[model samples]
Target chain A: MITRFLSEVRTSFNPFSPLSKTARTFLAQLPPDARATGMLIKHTILPRTSTQKPLLFVKFKDGKELKLDLETMRSTEVMAEVDRHSRILARKEELSG
Target chain B: MPPRIRLQTRQLKVRIYHHQIPSQPCFYASLATATTPAPPIEQTIHSVSPIARFPPTQPPSHKPPEVRKSQLHREYQSLLKSSPLVLIFQHNNLRAVEWMGIRRELAIALRKVDAELAATGHKDLYADAIKIQIIQTGIFASALRVVEFYNPESTELPTQHPSNPATATLAHGLSRQAHEAASDRKKKLDLAPLLSGPVAVVSFPAVSPQHLKAALSILSPSAPNFPAPKRKANPSYHEPAVQNGIQKLMMLGARVDGKAFDQEGTKWVGGISGGLDGLRGQLVGMLQNVGAGVTNALEGASQSVYFTMEGRKYMMEEAEKGPEEKKGGEEAKPEGEEAKPE
Candidate 1:
């Protein structure tokens, strides 16, 4: 996953819900020092009885925000969706620097 | 043929013995004494008890018994059974140094809690028993399933083989019975979703919310009640490795008293005013209040009845006394006043 371009991440899901696997895995996939390098990660845990869908919100370095519903999405799919925007940012950075 | 026989007798030489000559037997088997014959296979098989093939401790497992996964499954089952409170975490590529730092800080915080508890005359310090350990996610989930679902004493075990009871006596965590019981997909565990991707667990021997609060403060600190130790109070907690490790570790959820709880629920458990004793105290207080309310209600009804009865008795006595008391007072007070009434 291209996490370098991500500036902020907000995730909310019930840990007991099976659909929240993607959201949990996405959080796990972040680098250990993702927070130290100016990345903001905040995850909220909904209660067990909650019927709300799992959500992942990401803010890229270029101010592009992506809101994802992780209900049916796998972790790989979530990563692919984020990387689609990140690859462009990576190209832009390479060209400029 | 006659010539051949004569030649054999001619070539033979006879040897003379010095003492009384004794003839030795050609076969050694003839000289040996006879012993009792062995028992028949049928009698032996029927009479003897079954011999145990495997060791007493290491029972045969559904999976390969010697593998690390099977052993871990057994260990995890024991862990789940022993500890009523377990906090699960997702550790993302934390280094050795980071793990060490985190463990060190955790020990320090837990020991401090223990010391405080000791000062207040609390027994059963769990500072040494509580620890954070990385686990194989799949094995742990299987173990959790076995712990949750497999009830050996209650359910009937299938006949492995009636002829040989030695092969199928065990109902341990890694046994076939446990595997079958836990294999049902229809019955899902609430903790199933949380046991994924580099999982670790912190198990407590008992559900002591004070210790849990201390542990949560060190590992996954929230702002209000479970704030991280300040830099000045404990500078080691602020080290880069520990901080980075703490940042990477996401508090997934908890399994408390066999029930799965989310992050909020876990915090609520830790936020319990006191440990089990405190919870018991609260329960006692609530029950006492209820008792008091019930008694007060009953007293109110009985008191009202008593007041009504007293008023009735007063009215009855007053009616019985009638005008006798009034007549006596009138006679004592006035002689001319009696003449005024016609």
Candidate 2:
């Protein structure tokens, strides 16, 4: 998971639902020092009877926001999508130096 | 030279008589004529108790009993069965320091509750037994299945076998009967979904709302109902490590008395005023109110009927007096006539 390029993360999911596995996995993969390293992370846990799907929002350092549907997507797919944006940032930094 | 070791023919004890043949098949049959005896007389007369092949404490298990996983499964089964209240949490990448701080704070809070309970003469103090422990998710889920689905009565035989009956009647959580019951895919548990990932549980030996309130406020604080301890009251709680640990932990749900509850439901349980005793008091109050209402309803009907009768009698007296007053022009005449019963 390419988390260096991410600035913010927001998610809301019902833990009782099986579909929330990815959403929880995404949170678990974050570095322990993510907050100290200037990344903002916030999450909301829905009740058991809720009909809402798990939602994840990612904001990159260059002002690009990605909204993901975690109900249909897997943890690996989520990481790949985030890494796509991070790879571009990494390339630009290398070129500027 | 003659050898001195040679045996003399006269000294030999063997005697051969080819003319006399024995009736038995073997020559030794005449010497071993005793037959094997029958079984004990008591065993034949009465049904004997079945002897267990294995030790009473350790029964044969479906899975290997020597492994750590099996032991943990048994432990978790006991945990689920014993505790009436279990709060589940999802822990994310928390360091050891954070867990230590969180545990320390939790212990302090529970101790505070124990002190209060002791003051009021309540003996069911579970402060020492309650703890937040991380578990093997797969084993815990399997154990939960066994706890929820397996019934000891369903596997028991009507009559014990004459010998080694213990092997046939194994009803332990790790036995083949339990595994078969729990492994059926059709049966589902309400708490199954929350059993994945790095799961942790806070189990209470008994459901005490006061202790729950304290644990919730420390672990996941929501204002007014369950607020964080004040800085002045508890300085250690406000430490950064505890706060960080608390932040990473997300409360998933609760299982209370085998019933599943979400976050809102968990809070509702914690919000119970007082504890079991408080709930009992509320029930008593409601019943007393119902009793009072029933009595009031019955009394109201009779009272209304009585009032109606009194009103009608007063009206009749007024109607009778209307003409009497007109006939008796003087007031003194009316008073004297009334006294004379005219």
Candidate 3:
């Protein structure tokens, strides 16, 4: 049963598909801490669902792709997150200096 | 309550006396004073915003969730005393809209700083620099939780998973635990403050020359010092329509202290600091314990798992005991522990 389930998951996963490829490229190419990143991703990625959009993606420094939904993209909450990251980056730079 | 108006100045009378003899002292006590116009008994009524009249509403005395003032100040001073100053702009009391504008302005100013340094043949001095950070303390519950991160060099904004009302746990411990776990992850990267620290807090309705000057001063510490810049003459003062419009807009609501669209003033509020890492760790642990409990409860509730407070608490207790029992068995009798099968 476990082997069958693994095979099913493996068969379903397709990075070569247009949507997946686009998302992966978007995540990799965009710089961190941009105001336009969310909007750009939303517009660029075509939603599969008729009702609403699915999760967007962002890449971290270590090349980790984090999922963010439409609400998160539009929310002013991003300001707080961005501000926090800047401080951390600043601290890192300071320590390195 | 009707706003109270205060009289600005008192009327005064002056008498002029020419040289007079002792007996006829009043002889030259001038009737000439009558030629002088009476001091205008004009009352200049300066209207004060009602928000200014009353004290800011204090958070509950037990403990406010925001960072403390002293810590921010300490951090700020320490940064300042360093070889190169870390010029931080701490913003509190900004509404959502004003914060957006200020952030944009900050980005532009940073770009301009780079340009100016390069233009002035100070390329080498660019290495000796200023680190600019803007901290927002208003509107959020936890001071340590970073809502957003921006880098001038970066092309995109990085945000964390936003808190949602639906998924939010009712249990204070569990909710706090989740927040701490998340905040800890942010803090480890130095994105969030390690503890509440002193911050140079300022309130300005919009970005102006003063902000630029402050940035410039910090960015080029070796530059010639000039006398403090004169306060800019408010154009609204000359234009009554603009002033009236501002007052009307302020009255419409979302006034920061009842004085909305206040493009005139800037002030430094006190310092504020973030929470401790240890607190975050404890909360993270609690969150894990609660999560395990919730999972187990869900599994056991094959018929129905009610996500009520009591049910969650019961699960958490159950979850808490399982780990301890496992640990005890393993420590007490390693062979027997291995022999036991599910």
Give lDDT tens digits, candidate 1, residues B106-222.
999999999999998999799999999999999899999999999998888764453575656577878888889999999998888888888999999999999999999999999
- Which lDDT tens digits does candidate 3 get at residues A14-61? 121222322232232223222222222222322222233334443444
Of candidates 3 and 1, the better by lDDT: 1
The reply for model 1, stretches above 4 Å from the true place, is B1-48, B158-162, B319-336, B339-342
TM (chain A), candidate 3: 0.38
lDDT of 3 by residue, B178-239 (tens): 23443554443221221112122222222223333443332222223312212262222223
Worst 10 residues of 2 chain B by lDDT: B155-164
Writing each residue's lDDT as its tens digit, candidate 1 over A9-58 gives: 99998877889888888988888778888999988878878999999999
Models 1 onward score TM values of: 0.82, 0.83, 0.17
DockQ of every predicted complex:
0.69, 0.83, 0.01
Q: How big is the RMSD of model 1?
A: 8.0
| Model 3: CAPRI class | incorrect
Q: List the lowest-lDDT window of 10 residues for candidate 2 chain A.
A: A30-39
Backbone clash count, each prediction separately: 0, 0, 31
**Tens digits of lDDT, candidate 2, A28-88:** 9998878878899999999888989899999999999999999889999999999999999
* After superposition, candidate 3 runs with Cα above 4 Å error: A1-97, B1-83, B88-90, B124-342
By DockQ, rank the candidates, best first.
Answer: 2, 1, 3
Residue B129 local lDDT, model 1: 98
- When just chain B is superposed on the true chain B, each candidate scores a TM-score of 0.78, 0.78, 0.20
